[model samples]
Target: MGRGRGRDYTGRTMPSPSSAIRPKRGKKGSETPIVTPVSARKRVAPSRQVVRGDRGVKVTRAVTIRRSADELYAFWRQIENLPRIVKHPLTIERVSDIASHWAASAPVGDRRVEWDAVIINDEPGKLIAWRSREGAEIPNAGTVRFAPAPGDEGTEVTVTLEYNPPAGKLGAWFAKLSGQEPAQQVTEALRRFKALMEAGEIPTTEGQPSGRPQNTKAKRS
Candidate 1:
């Protein structure tokens, strides 16, 4: 203690530097955190195909009518007669040389389906094609072709149709359950049209009378 050393009040001897002094520790080793910018990210837009899903309906069918191509084409070109021939509740109003308004049966009587359509192609006595306008009640398009049969069997009428029903394919299936399928309706329409054109009347078990012809006279004199 007398050899140049410091001591506490109660200490008989003070610890030497060799035993008391020690090195201090460095700061804990830890890496800094990093951040990313929002502007450097990738984004994707929606696709129409996914939204559309499986809502398309396509049908191709043909019928051979005992009438000439020109006669069939002329009769079909008169849009007003569609309701009578289609075998469904339908009405067509001509807007111009290329456009028209159409209404067809749906579920109820007064609450029918309606749309506007424009004639896209018109090959006289051969083909007629049409498509519905944008935002229609039921979007649709179709084509009708009239060609001479191989023999004297009149004309071969081929109809091709593609449509997006209001309820899509599901709607078509539902229509089948309700006996309102378009394909069957078209086939029946073609058959009825053939009967009407060739026989001047559509046959019915109800015995309904056919309308008078253009060359009919009465004995009113």
Candidate 2:
């Protein structure tokens, strides 16, 4: 037979030379045809990480505001004011002497999740801390500290946070990809806080009178 154009041994239409077929054998005796399907094979996702301990990723940030230590501390002391400066503003539902209930937008893999946290360490204007209490899509803990700048009239605010992301590599991957890097978020928040405090206005809520006493409690350096 005069070399028929792209004819196979069975005399059926054959694929072009550019499109060749290679057969692959599988672990089983059956041959797994290596034909390239019109559609690609679905990717296999990497396994997720399991939760081990209560410990989470820790991050810290510090910034100096133009306001005095007393002013900054006073503003921070009001748990209700958190939503004004926090990257993801949170609503304070219940406030008490030592504890508060909060709801805020939190981060998840490529998404924003809502969570509820309970205030833990409430040392007035000096320090405040909270942990995920309920409705926590991503478990986390946070602390804010206020101090006086050395030799300067300004106030220095440091914020520390730890988060236990959802049980998956996706969580870890997304955490790294988050726009609000924990440290950067704190720094930017402090900067915004400084601007807002200097302007005598809280970012979200109505401007309140600003003559509160300084918190003299001890704070970390």
Candidate 3:
């Protein structure tokens, strides 16, 4: 007898178990991994925002000066007085009839920043507006307006300044904390200018002695 023969011996064949192996059943303890359906996922739209650093900090300040508008405008035309009025270490040198060069110190270190600006608009005894030239240290523009006060109440000097801070909004906030903010600086400058133009000097407490000088000394006695 041969196994290959479908029929054996007397033309009759016995039934045999199936030649193909059946697949083993899964264990009772086995579990299928749960997959989240794509329809259940949340889709979020992207946000459109104006970056803080890209926008500038705008500061507007006004003060009343007893001097005439013409006189005030003439006084301001001399840019040399700017450094004295401003709290920051800065200087402005005239380049031409309508252009000037500005130099300022960095807030954190010994770096020097320079820029050139051309007067875009100027109305005698009324307004002056300027914008920084191309490739300046930082983008900046400003306008100052002089208006006559009512009832002979001197002149109203309005200043508007805008600049993109290096470190963005956070840096502007930090500068405000340190009293170097643009608003504070412009306000104080106006105050100083008022005092200087009216009183011929800026009042100070430098000569007055303080209650405690011990902290200032390197070594206490």
Candidate 4:
């Protein structure tokens, strides 16, 4: 029966030794393995673009006020007094020593948009810087600096600001397209400051009540 089975199996040929055998291993259990093809990696750089505006706008305005540095700095240092001079005065509510909340209305196209800013840098008689708070509708940062003029007889005040309008690119484009002037605003504020300082009086807040009585009646004789 074994001979018959072998004769029948002979009709089918077996696989070659080389094809049927497994890869041999090295003596120390280390064997040469098949190598995988490595893919090439390319690095890409990110583009630098302003999310609000293509390029930031820097506004600088300076004026030589006929006042001493101390006087100019004194008035400018009072952030709460800004409304008296600033063309677009905003209500500033002090929150702490280093921070204050601000609400100002800024022109945007045909209408105005309200912004809430937070005071950042406050150096008496020197500089004041502020930016919009976290949840403000419009984002902006502005600085006001006071320095003595060359002659030391007058103060040279400079104002610089970087604001991201509410409308984003559209607002920036509109501001550029409208040709709306900033000089007038700056000049007006300076004029107001000059008037206030020269008059030797700071503007009074309407919210405060006068200590004197509105009217008094005389006693009948």
**Best-matching candidate per TM-score:** 3
Q: Which stretches of candidate 4 lie over 4 Å from their true place?
A: 1-55, 105-114, 168-179, 200-221
RMSD of 3: 32.6
Q: What digit string (tens of lDDT, one per residue) describes model 1 on residues 1-221?
A: 24323222223333322221221123111111011111111221121221233454544456788889999999889888778887666789999987999976665443667789887678898878777777776566677888888987898887756565556654654465325445555566777888899899998866334445532343224
lDDT against the true structure, per candidate, is 0.60, 0.52, 0.60, 0.50
Clashes of each: 0, 0, 0, 0
- The TM-scores, one per candidate, come to 0.64, 0.54, 0.66, 0.54
Q: List candidate 2 stretches off by more than 4 Å.
A: 1-55, 105-112, 168-177, 201-221
How close to the true structure is residue 13 of candidate 2, measured as C-alpha lDDT? 43
Tens-place lDDT per residue, model 4, 166-201, is 467546643553234333355457667866877765
lDDT of model 2, residue 180: 26
Q: How high is the lDDT of residue 77 in model 1?
A: 91
Candidate 1's TM-score reads 0.64
The C-alpha local distance difference test score for the whole of candidate 2 amounts to: 0.52
| Cα displacement (Å) at residue 120, model 4 | 2.8
Q: What is the per-residue lDDT of model 2 for residues 46-162, given as tens digits with 9 covering 90 to 100?
A: 111111153344444566676676667677677677677766555775556545666544454444455565655555556666666544656666667777778876766767555
The global Cα lDDT (0 to 1) of model 4 is 0.50
Residue 30, model 2: lDDT of 16
